[model samples]
Target: MYEYKCVELRSKMFGGALSGDKLERVLNEWAAKGWQLKSTAAVDVKGRIGPGGTDGLLITFERQKG
Candidate 1:
């Protein structure tokens, strides 16, 4: 069975405001890359890899079988 997890992403840096639907669209795009859609509840984190504290949870296709 596939599993899901929560995710979070910032907007201001992306140029446009982020919406829940937008996040879903992202999730779908990510699914194409093999990451399953888990959750969208994101918390705040400081700093960033790019402009606008750009960071969020990514997905993995293979579960750790723990």
Candidate 2:
């Protein structure tokens, strides 16, 4: 069995950069807790302008059930 986690990255919070020290810290923190990255993808956040207009990132992680 496995467990999963999702991390959302917002452009406003990250200044449009996805990979950074903050992200690394988060990953490391989870890694220490036995989580591993499974996948990542660009997500389009719905905005006032239109759908698929806002840039975002989605990080998926998985870990063995304990």
Candidate 3:
């Protein structure tokens, strides 16, 4: 069996921008906890922006259930 986890990366967490280094650190931390990245999605806060002005990233992860 497998377990899943979801992490929300908000732009505001990095002063309104998501930096690669910061993201890597977060991912690495999860990896240390035995979670593997599964997928990612850009989440827009509003529909009127036409995919612009994304609020953050939705990161999905999975791992074996021990």
Candidate 4:
């Protein structure tokens, strides 16, 4: 069987774009721990004090369970 992990990535800048560098860093970090990318999805996450939501990414990873 396999295990999975999910991570939510939000833009650091307000009304700006998500950082490619940040995404790469997270991918590499997980890779180092033997996790392989499973999938990614775009989503709008609601904020604490807003009627709207913020753009974000839902990253999923998987690895064989030992």
Candidate RMSDs in order: 5.3, 2.9, 4.2, 2.3
Lowest summed lDDT window (length 10), candidate 4 = 10-19
lDDT of each residue in 1-66, candidate 4, tens digit only: 999999887664324677778788889999999999999999887767869778889899999999
Which run of 10 residues does model 2 get worst, by summed lDDT? 45-54
Q: Which residue pairs collide, candidate 4?
A: none
The residue ranges of model 2 lying beyond 4 angstroms of the native Cα positions read 46-53
**Winner of 3 and 4 under TM-score:** 3
**Top lDDT prediction, candidate number:** 3
| Per-residue lDDT value at 35 in model 4 | 98
Off by over 4 Å in 1: 1-8, 49-66
Clashes of 1: 3
What residue pairs are clashing in model 2? none
Error at 47, model 2, angstroms: 6.7
TM-score, one value per model: 0.47, 0.70, 0.82, 0.79
lDDT of 2 at 34: 90
Best by TM-score: 3
Native-to-model Cα distance after best TM-score fit, residue 58 in candidate 1, in Å? 8.1
